[model samples]
Target: MFQDPGVGVFQAWDYVVFAALFVISSGIGVFFAIKERTKNTSKEFLVGGKQMTCVPVALSLTASFMSAVTVLGTPSDVYRFGGSFIIFSIAYTMMVTLTAELFLPIFYRSGITSTYEYLELRFSKAVRMAATLIYIVQTILYTGVVVYAPALALNQVTGFNLWGSIFATGIVCTFYCTLGGLKAVVWSDVFQMVVMLMGFFTVLIQGTIKNGGPVAVWKAAQEGSRLNVFDFDPDPLRRHTFWTISIGGTFTWLGIYGVNQSTIQRCISCKSEKQAKLALYLNLLGLLVILVCAVFSGLVMYTFYAKCDPWTAGFVSAPDQIMAYFVMDILGHMPGLPGLFVACAFSGTLSTVAASINALATVTYEDFIKYWFKNLSERAGTWISKGLCIVFGVACTTMAVAASYMGGIVQAALSIHGMCGGPMLGLFSLGILFPWTNWKGAAGGLLAGITLSFWAGIGGFVYPAPASKMMPLHLNTSGCELRNSSDILTTLAPTMAPERPALADSWYSMSYLYYSAVGWLATVIAGLVITFLTGPTRGGDIKPVLIRPVCNLLCFWSEEYRKACWCGVEHDAADMDLSGDYISTDILAMRREEPTEISKKDGKDSGDDLPGHIAEDRSYTNAGFTKDTDL
Candidate 1:
């Protein structure tokens, strides 16, 4: 058996290369951020001035989706659970399409800076606050865990302390985000994605060549049963059956792409609705590429070290470090290769971290602070966002330190996102679909959904044991052991406990795909029931334009309400003639003409009276509705 290579194997060149890459990427981000400062209107700062192209936006989305947890943890997942995890990609594809078709149009049409603004439009201020708060909590926790995972991997490969790595990463991310805004984030993401993909494919190719080519690698994976993708058992208790994976995984993806600001923020920054849709398609293609590369990487690693078994041999204490181990040990001697790989890993980590920081800062500034400080100036708001980004960066770093101690870092991060994401998506859906659902119902239902999800997620931790004390009904009792003989039962006996089974502490341990479903169903049912019990509101209050197009298409507007109400006034216009070209001439003609019944009946009076401010504002409004309202 080959002896394990300890952490000392990482040379000084690794650190030098990683540091240089970090400095260069971060410097570019800072330069962009400084350039942005001069032209930094609220729109530009928050959403890259809403003029991003599809390629950069798609790359940013890919970078954000493929975080450090993805880089380090995905291979570990394949190594541990076989290839069934690839089935989750189906759910991801469905969610991205749904977001492009259903969610993106509403957000773009509304012209809102933050996604949670829809909650205020559809529900009440309370629901918006609740959703934003939940997002902040979820993003911070998820970012922290993702930040921690790579640090853990680096710690295993190099001798650098995990906490130190976390601090260094957080500081670099914080600096660029504070300086640059969304523009910096997007550009950095483009650079990061290129580096990360190159590094990943390079490692995969190198590993494949070393393992006697693709044929031998596939043969080994098949021999070890690592190639199984379709397991269609009907057991909900099983972690990765086709049914559980598809249904739960779809909802999980929906929560991230449909509602989460980190991903949607990129989509909303696109130049047009068509570009946003195109970005979604590109993201789907990228996801497919990521899955294929990541799985192949794992298969190659398994084949190379089939006999040595690094974790069991004590080279690394955790499965998460397996990828790192292979990279450092196998590719260490190749000049500049280790540096490129480490740089790529750090680039992925920083890109996602920067995006998360920028998004959270935007949400906090627009949703929470601005809600209370109504008269805040534009410059003051900008400064507030910058401060918040720094504060959020530090908070995430602290959480990263905490996450380093946890098991299954990727699963934990995804689970946290899934738990909170469901309610946010449900709240948004209600806002679009059910016009009758009032603020009280929305607020109450959102609270109920969040509470239920949290309890379900934390229940086992709080309760600590089963009531019967005879093995817990829902827990798995199976065990794995190293066999000394051909008899399976005898080989597994040592690993098996006589009386009790241990609980899985990994975040992905219990399928997280179900978390979003639970939250979504709870929120929908509770919101609907509460709305029914309470009486519906009168017509004037409902804003049809603010509602989702699908919802508006299904619900008919009353003729009486349509004419008298302010809600659908814009919709009544035949050609939306809010332009001011005829303002000077038309107003003069109206003033000279007789104040007859003809004007009143034709709604010409409303059209002709153009105050100086009104004419200019209307001209701008004709350009596009300003998203300056609280909602």
Candidate 2:
């Protein structure tokens, strides 16, 4: 049996405030959906009719990035590992700039609703299917964990049953997502982002004030060595070092910014390429603010409980429960603060789940169902999209329940996503960078990448060091100590043990930064080597024209090598057919060879391209084309 932390009993005002907040926030979603029902074109539903501005995109991007993991897990990370995790913000900053300078131009110019559509254009149908499937699986699992973490936290804090919380949250999110589509999700995310930041900063400031001041907090952190940031020892087995955090962290960040649908979908929906880039930059600013607040809150927690150590005092067992413990007990006496914090924490979970459900629905409707049905009616498609939201929502809710047994939602989610994401990123990279990679190479590389990552993850768990003396340099750190000890104790302690070894869990507990490198290397090496051995693919099968210049920059091939390999037929710089607007080869040839620059004076290309009519008719009759197969 569970007991409600008596905070619920004394704080009727807080509960009332929270309930009102929930009603208002959720009511906004329902209202938006009801009002926007008539505006349910596929484009509008999936990508906001590609007219979303920078501010909303920036806000929604922040909300999506800081999920339940950041709300609950970042504090836990700080509590367990200290401020070393802050290095991740540096990686995130680099990723934002990289995305803006590299990937955004290609995706925006392509003008596809789904970013994965670019995979098909550059690579083969098989590669696109594989990459999209990986994303779908990874996101469902990721959403399941996100939905689960907060419900569990809220269950601990508010005494609601875990299943009940999961069901309630999932149902509400699914409802709005199914009905309102991307617009509702994005706008609601803007609201949720504000609440989340307010909640975190409120607790942070109040916690710091109660702990005497920033001086006291810093002194407490320094006493506990919580402020130490740089750990530069070169050990692969260690967790939270500069090397692991930077290199591994960069790839992990790249996976989210570069490959994930939930984030990139926002970028693709911008009103212009410039707006998309601006949103990316603004997201970086928001991330920096949130990271400071979250890290500072953790330091404040150290100050508040430095002497008492409430965790050891039997107040809470798990690190994740630290924030709740602070809110309910430390800040319990304050009025309205507790409710606001709870709302803020819950906002992270809700916004992420809602965004994910929307992305999942779009992928299902566009990629899977449409592929089979060929031409489903708009009404039927809408129903199917709604139905998928319900089905996946329930499935994710169940998985969230299962996540409880996994231990540490943040680490679990990151590890699982890393395993799958590496290959997906690799596939996209190969498609964009290497035009010669055939379906066989791409598919083979994907399989190999996943296999190697799984093997490495398992090996890190089972075998920390080699049996023979000639093994590679085994520089173990405190993070890998547990796993190393566990393996040695299990083997030697049973037969001729003199004393028990102090063991950490398997290196499987290694910080998640390593997973991306392991996956990326495995895929790229296998894919490139196998493809090279197989020789260049057929020219018809290779879409060299679709490979972006930015991708080529990442490739090792020199500029001269690229030019020599292209065999003299230059890919037309101005040829873009992604809008399903095809120009015949004859027409293209007949057009002036020299570039005709369009003047900005007329405001022609600068304005939004969305049609004005509510029900605009699209004809498939340019040059006798019968079916809309371009998509």
Q: What is the TM-score of each candidate against the true structure?
A: 0.82, 0.82
TM for candidate 1 is: 0.82
CA shift at 145, candidate 2, in angstroms? 1.5
Assess candidate 2 and give its TM-score to the true structure: 0.82
* Residue 620, candidate 1: alpha-carbon lDDT: 21
Each prediction's RMSD over C-alphas, in Å, is: 7.8, 8.6
Candidate 1 lDDT trough over 10 residues, lowest sum = 469-478
Candidate 1 whole-model C-alpha lDDT, 0 to 1: 0.70
* Clashing pairs in model 1, backbone N/Cα/C closer than 3 A: 33-180, 44-49
lDDT by residue for model 2 (1-631), tens: 2233443422777677666655665777687677877876676677776778889999998888788788888876676557777887878888788777666655554445566766665656667677778888878878888888777677767677878888887887777777677888888889889988888888888887889989998997887787787888667666678887777877777877876788878887776667778888999998888888788887787667666554434445566877777777666787777777777777888788888888887776666787688667777877787788778777777777667766667666777767787777787776655656666777788888888766655544443332221111112122211223554455335454233223323344454567877788778778888888887555444333245533334432565654444433244435435642223332243233222222122533221122110112111111112232222
lDDT of 1 at 152: 74
lDDT of 1 at 269: 79
